[model samples]
Target chain A: MLILQKISQNKTLAATINQIHYVVIIGEGLVGGALRDYLINTFNYKFFYNVKTPWTDKTLIEAHFNELKTFIFEKIFNSQKTELAAPSFLQLSFVWSAGKAGFAASFTDIDEEEKDFHSFLNLLTQIDQERPAFVKMDLHFTSSAGGLFEGQSSVQEDSQPHPLRPYGILKLRQEQKITEWSQNKSYFHGVIYRLSTVYGRIRRGQRMGLISIMLQNGLHKKITPITGDLYTLRDYVHSMDIARMITSGMISSHKPHKSPSNNLQVLFGLSQKPTSIFEIKAIIEFHLKHKIYIQFNHTPGNARDITFGKIQPPFEVQARDIRSGIKDVLTDWYGAHT
Target chain B: MEGTLSVSTITPVYCGAQYLEELIKQLERVRQEWQSKNYPIQIVESIFVVDAAKDDSLAILKTISNNKAYPWIKVIELSKNFGQHPATMCGVLYSTGDWLITLDEDLQHHPREFIELFKAFAASSYDVVYAKPKDSVHQSLFRDWGSRGYKKLIAKITKNPFVIDFNSFRLIRGSIARAAASVCGHETYFDVAICWFTNKITTQKLSLEDQRYINTGTSSYNLFSLLSHARRLIVSSQTKILRLGAWIGIASILLSVALGLHFLYLKIYDPEAIPVRGWTSLYLTLLFMGGLTSTLLSIIIEYLSSISLQNQGKPLFFMVDRSSDALIQKFLNHEPIDH
Candidate 1:
């Protein structure tokens, strides 16, 4: 009877501490790192990252879940331990798994591709199932706007994705699963950020982008072969801008979840306008103050190599100028080399 | 001819944003004049290779290219500032016309005089024609004299009289220009590469003005830039200069041998005729050593020169398109040449 009464009091205390929100980030990579730093520095939200492993050890996965559960419980009950007050809302941001290789792999690797898909699905399932039961859990997922709408010139939140590659197909499937799961639950609120081509300083073991490759070649004074033609255009956004948009969308009072109309909202996260490969090369060369020798290969054309239309982000955000962004990246690279 | 021949004027721009507008205006005027006069040639495109200028030259060029009135204007922004010659080669590679005329972006090479060069090519049946200024060039006296002296020296050394006629403002057949540019390496002087392909070169006299020099009282070529040009010119030429070293070594050795024999003959005849006791041996030793050193140095120089030429993509043999001459003649006469 005494233990039952204590449980009843604990439930009342948990409801009182529900004013504070906790954000759990799944992947800690280039975009994830930026988003994690942004959420902590801007909103002072408590941050937790999922343990990264190959998922071969069931004991390791269970231990990780137990550790996360204990951390969340302590944050809710022991408010005096941390610098910030107890959490009211819990926001979970997922930004992991999948890259260019998933798209570039041939049909002969179907089995491997399927394995990758299942691994991602299983990850999401585990997260959804094992989330803290004491608090209201909000989810934020990042999907690729460029990959999903591969050959399409212009894409919007409502545009039906006609994915051409396996990577895009897998991304679309993940989006569908998240959307379906987010619906039919009043307590759940989710935001899907469809990101454009993100360019920034990639962390170690992170997926490399064109900008990073060009900058690295320029710094080393090496020749960089262009796989695409001069006219291949891409919409580039700084990773920090995406992080800021995600955080701002979460904190705003008129968020998608707060709306009486819909529980799930999709937003595009694009910073800079569309730029071509030729223009990007010129900008990088200008910043480096050296000539980057280029040899054009005779590779067959890719379907996604078409020019992109103007990008319209969901909200207004300060976009960094590409020239200065290149300068900053080159400067950082020079620092590292030196 | 299936259609009238088209011409492209390629200008490599570097810190010439201030003069770009005026340059384009003059080029447009020349194009309009050619069309109105019923000339068989049309200025199809005016390609400007912007060599990553420090100024706002690229933005100005973008504005001009975007304007509907200047549809023929095509701007190619290079990855970085490759000097004037490489930039010109880049423009040449991008050109698509029957004839390509390269000029400076400073408006010193007037577009109005292109007709004279075309006429010169028609009359002489030459593959390339250079526009030589008839009047005193509007450069400072020092630069003008330095340019003249340098050209004369290069002509004398390389034994190629065509070096004297080389100028920035020139007309070349598009096919040959692209071919030469393709084989041009970082050290290859563009005009010297053209010379390697053909000796059929001529010059047309035109009155010219340098408005930029007249207004600013300073030319872009400094002492260092002049030295760099001289180095490229000497490197691109055949190793005739090194051959001169070998000839000198041989001549000295022959002369010294004759002198030594004469001294020995005199010693045998009469010891009283010797000027000093040990002077003959000392002089003989010095002559032999000097001649030997010169010979060895010349051989080393020849070997190094061959290596450099190979690195510069000097071909053992190249085929010239004889059919282009017939096309040029047809374009000149405004009638198709019969097969």
Candidate 2:
């Protein structure tokens, strides 16, 4: 009987200890960071990697999984982890667990066309060698689902994921790769969730999106250029919604089946209703109470990602409408920044 | 109308005893269905290549062959214990047919899918028919990702756009099978090399019957076995130097040097505009790079497995312990294995 262990990049592994284990996650990008926060806040889990105080609020944000920092680097990165002395301090905060890993390795700006998707798969392979775990979900991009399965059109029962960008196309190929891998039965469960643009309050100078960039422009009264038609639809869900869906599905006794297969389920993350970029701008403008000049130039952005028909989960939240979500963002922003 | 086929196939008696019986039963159903469909499945031959099984599986296989009466059947027991792939090759080497289907002893690949593969092969102009899994036979995300990574890497090596199949099931023409086996000499992976060897490939997507893992019972490929498999396809493939060099140059040293030169020039010319006036950020940067370099170095080092294999001139597999060269002769004396 050979005992196996998965030494995850998260410094902390996502799975409960298994007798034989393997875990695979890649990039440790924005969504991945939020996943770590979900694990820390929801489970009150501690690890040996980083220097940061534990998170208490049920808020979600993203960060990379640091293998070297363990529980040691959390404090180093989170100088405020000890200074913020109360539970009421939950306006908006995050403790990044930095490590000897490449948190500061810089590279020249890459051409948008120069990215290699195959290398991304290879990097995933490298990560798996450190800790081998069956990936439950492949959080990436996609395109059409070829045709209907069991009856419903893909966009109706499944995520009708037709991604328009090269990045998303790479992600689509990845999803295909994951599905095929799951088929090979290398001890892997295949789950993929195509997420909407994740949004929430953030400490400026991070990300290039409507929420962060718009918030910055609104604060500075800088004119923000609108990409594409102002009404381009985006299924922007709360970062918490992203966190909630993943944790619940993974830990839940009954793993949600996209179909009865229990092998592959690809889903889309959205509110009960779809929201457009223009609608988001209106909400932010109304709540922030500051109307920065809107330079409307309709050149288009993000290959116009295809939409999906809403599949309501039984545990759906009445869910903050666009207006409410904007308020939540503004309130969290003011409280955190101030 | 037999839309599906059931046939009892066996991986034979050897160490695969753990997996043989279940494989036979799965194929038995497929074989039965093929007959019921009135399908023109050239003469069906039940094949068993008994390499020293070291367990009851071989005996069980013997018991099975003794008890059963069906189409033309033959068991080729080697003189000693040869591994599964070599034994399989030995079985295929002598197969008398225009097409040959090979599968693992593990129950991950259901033999019932032969009809689907056969039908797809019939419908297409392509010589190779690949049965793609709609999902996985195992439940781990890491292994799935790693397997995918391996496929991509091998694809890169061969410069052949690989149409990955559910490696557990595939059907190829007799000529292609022999050709692939010849080119793969002593390499652990036969499936991937086949992909490298072929240009025309088609895929048929199918789903696993839910209890895939429990059905396989336990995998014979332990952690070491899995890694070795990865090494064989990626690191030990016929072309590693050019691929490895291109990869390292593109990924690591070149980028590192460019960054280093840029930072050095920045520090030497304009000390006033140094991004880091203090040493804290510098220390953090150093720690980060130190770790990154070490990790990448280790990755590059792992690609050296082919060197060891070539140096010893050690063959990858050896045929062993066979009791029935005469039985194989006798079976052939009657008719071909495929007959």
The best candidate by lDDT is: 1
lDDT of 1 by residue, B2-107 (tens): 3356688999988898989999999999999988865667787888999988888899999989877776788878889888899998787666566889999888
Superposed model 1: Cα runs more than 4 Å off? A1-338, B33-38, B139-141, B322-324, B327-339
State the DockQ, from 0 to 1, for candidate 2.
0.00
Residues A235-261 of candidate 1 have per-residue lDDT tens digits of 677777777776665445233446543
> After TM-score superposition, what is the CA distance of residue B177 in candidate 1 from its true location, in Å?
1.5
Which ten-residue region of model 2 chain B has the weakest summed lDDT? B1-10
The weakest ten consecutive residues by lDDT in model 1 chain B span: B315-324
Model 2 scores a TM of: 0.35
List of chain B TM-scores, one per candidate: 0.91, 0.62
DockQ of the candidate models in sequence: 0.02, 0.00
Cα lDDT, model 1, residue A224: 74
